[model samples]
Target chain A: MKLLEEGIPLAELSIERIARTAGVGKAAIYRRWSGKEELFVDVVRSAEPADPELPGTSMRADLVVLLETQRQRGVFSRQSVILHNVHAQMKSSPKIWAAYQNTVIAPRRRLGLEVLRRGQSNGELRDDVDIELLYDLFVGPMLVRSVLRPDGDLPDGLAERIVDTLLEGLRPVSSRPG
Target chain B: MKLLEEGIPLAELSIERIARTAGVGKAAIYRRWSGKEELFVDVVRSAEPADPELPGTSMRADLVVLLETQRQRGVFSRQSVILHNVHAQMKSSPKIWAAYQNTVIAPRRRLGLEVLRRGQSNGELRDDVDIELLYDLFVGPMLVRSVLRPDGDLPDGLAERIVDTLLEGLRPVSSRPG
Candidate 1:
């Protein structure tokens, strides 16, 4: 993991090189993992922040925690050079990118879907909106700030603000006559 | 454009190579553009779909058009391998990426902002919410599907759906004991 953080391209990394750098025998690594690919998958998993233990108070509360996890990750991704490089390098290796997607992104997406599903069921969310679009609508802004527009600020209260804002929306309510 | 669409890594491409490929002299190319980076920037700009001549209509109508433009782009990006490769290649070349951002991305961002600012002023949007967040909220889901989650569907009517959904919001209207 340290070796990768140094921006060593994954293609150039070998188990023997890793062992030599760490002053350990190659056999030690082989005994723990099948190969570098397996090891790398593990390393990235360890590096990623774990999913939040939801509050279970309400779907709203649960979503706040979920998006907060994304906010924390956004902070981490911006700060962690190791993580930034791993994602960049992973894209270059199609096999590794696919593996990472299956292992990391897919599961996370499923977890998000499940939350929206529950919210719809509980009448917290409107059932008319497609649950998948709802998930993207809720999650997309943080991601836009995190990934697409680097200049966009991620200030504190972002998670709550995003959830609350989406829950209510940007349109001004009409002032109905009493 | 043809040269780039061929998937030749930009680093491996040169003015001379481009000229030769196009069956033109290097001097002819140089006569028009100063250098490769400048030429590359223009090629990408031309390749991108032109922005909509927004209907001088209500904010909701205009916003729907703006998002609909994004939806069109989302469609183009998915279909055009050239676009996908250009975006990927641009990321690898910091200088070109900066140039692209300046020429291509920055103006589009301003346009989106201007529309939102107008909406806020004209009572289409809530004055209390940050305009930037509002911009991202409207634009983010389309972009998320466009750039982040490729498997996330970008079906027809997505622009209208996102706009209408956001305008009203996801939270179900309270039953007023009618």
Candidate 2:
């Protein structure tokens, strides 16, 4: 990830190259991982930052912290390439697909549920909100932005705006209590 | 889309078969469009519905109609497919991607902005919310839910929950004067 994060394109990579770069023998690399694609997936899965604490504070503050830390490294920055490769490869390989589901999608879903549950119990989130559906709200926009505008950066405060809009509602309505 | 919406997989598609099914000559299809891929893109685009009209009522009603109508057919659903295909093709060819962005992405962005602007003018939306970023909030979750959990169907009353949680604020405190 450190290598990919620094903009190492995977097309230029090889198992032999990775071995040399990591200061290990080619045979040693082969014994553990079958090839470059597998190695790349391993790199991504093992390298993702540990999930952040849910904080149990105000939902705003907790969510703000949850997103900001991710922004520091850029969400799915390096993993985007791996994801592209994996999605295509999965067309032909079930094992790769399973690995991706388990390693990538499952963990994120679990973490999202954890935060939402914490927010609910702490009175920082709505009791009626479906945590899973809400997780889609938390993640969907950033993913769309990344897909649509790959070259465009996630502009400053965009994450906060997303969190705000999702929590507060984007509907234009008078707040008066009539 | 009828095919896909009916659960036919992409892997099952063939040029001759699709042309036969649609009652067009294979050569006629090829002369205007290169292959099934281009034909599919055009089919989706041409079928996209116009944007929903915004009633000048409460913001919540306006947003609900906007969201629910978006699900009716066309635009968002078709655009989502285009985005998925574009992302997938990004790894393989630049040409397909450029076509996808030009035909699908730009138009969607424009439509989303229009929705946000209308909300703002009616005093139903926050003056501080960035329109473009707000567009992200509006469209992101819908697309994400479609892509990740194609079968999970957006749950009952989920849209209302999203609006209430976001607009009313998720904080437990009673800030509004009693």
Candidate 3:
């Protein structure tokens, strides 16, 4: 993991080199994983915390946790360097790539949907808001911005603003106070 | 340029290879540009069109052009692939790096400022919309979305919906119609 976090390209890795650096015998390393790619995949899998338990709460609180998880990974974690390398490697390796999509991306998206579904049930979000379409709108822009400006100022309170604005526009118009 | 659009790694480039591909001599290639890096930089420089002229009409019209430009680049263009490679290369090459900052990113930001300034002058946007911050808000999210889901479905009328929502929130509270 440290090797990958240091911007090492995963494709060029060798098991012997990993074992040498770790002060272990090649047999010990080979006993644990099939190859360097599997070892690298294991390292990535170990980075994510256990799946967060979604609380039965208000939409704002639920979404804040969800968005914060993304922000931490997307903006604040050391894993970003690993994610970049993994993103590049996914173009070439299918096994590692499937692990990434399933472990990293799918769960985060599932949480977003859960929050939206909760909001709909509670009447805080509109019945008309397409949960799937709203998910795209909610997530798409931030991912695009991060790509363009990896270290640039993330609009402070962006998730809050998006949620607030969308909720405002989506509420039953007559229910809105002046 | 086509090679980059096809996901060819810039690190793998060689002058002899490029020349053979282009059906030109090494001298002919060197005559046009010093190296593959310079040639690739030239490709990025060539693709940027002059900023669309603002029509000095409503903020909606002026902003429609600006937001649409962002959407096109953020979502549709192969320019993003070059943009990503430029960022990755900046970690290594300082000279090609500095040129990218001054040329590609800074100019687009300045163009954004001009559009916002026009919005304030024409009374379409609120007097206190914070042009610099608004630039970040308007442009940042679209880029974030693109990087995350390069091939995801663009929600129907998503662009117009964003513009409408922003227009509503940014307008003076008193200006909002029932």
List the candidates' TM-scores in order. 0.91, 0.67, 0.67
lDDT score of residue B12 within candidate 2: 71
The candidate scoring highest on DockQ is 1
lDDT of 3 by residue, A90-125 (tens): 645767766666656777788788777777677655
Worst 10-residue stretch by lDDT in candidate 2 chain B?
Answer: B169-178
Give the alpha carbon lDDT tens digit for every residue of B2-103 in model 2.
Answer: 565554555576778777777888897788988666666676556566556767466666656655554444234444664344344443556655665677
For each candidate, what's the DockQ? 0.60, 0.45, 0.18
Q: Lowest lDDT 10-mer window, candidate 3 chain B?
A: B168-177
TM-score for the second chain in candidate 2? 0.58
Tens-digit lDDT string for candidate 2 (A28-116): 99999877767766765565565567665566766766665455435565456654443455544456656666776688677667777
User: Per-residue lDDT tens digits of candidate 1, residues A112-157?
Assistant: 8888888888888888898889999999998999877666698888
**Model 2 / residue A118 / CA error / Å:** 1.8
Q: Please tell me which predicted candidate would have the highest TM-score against the true structure.
A: 1
Tell me the tens digit of each residue's lDDT in model 1 across B58-104: 78888888888887777887788898888888887888888888877
Predicted chain A of candidate 1: TM-score: 0.87
Q: What is the C-alpha lDDT of each candidate?
A: 0.83, 0.62, 0.62
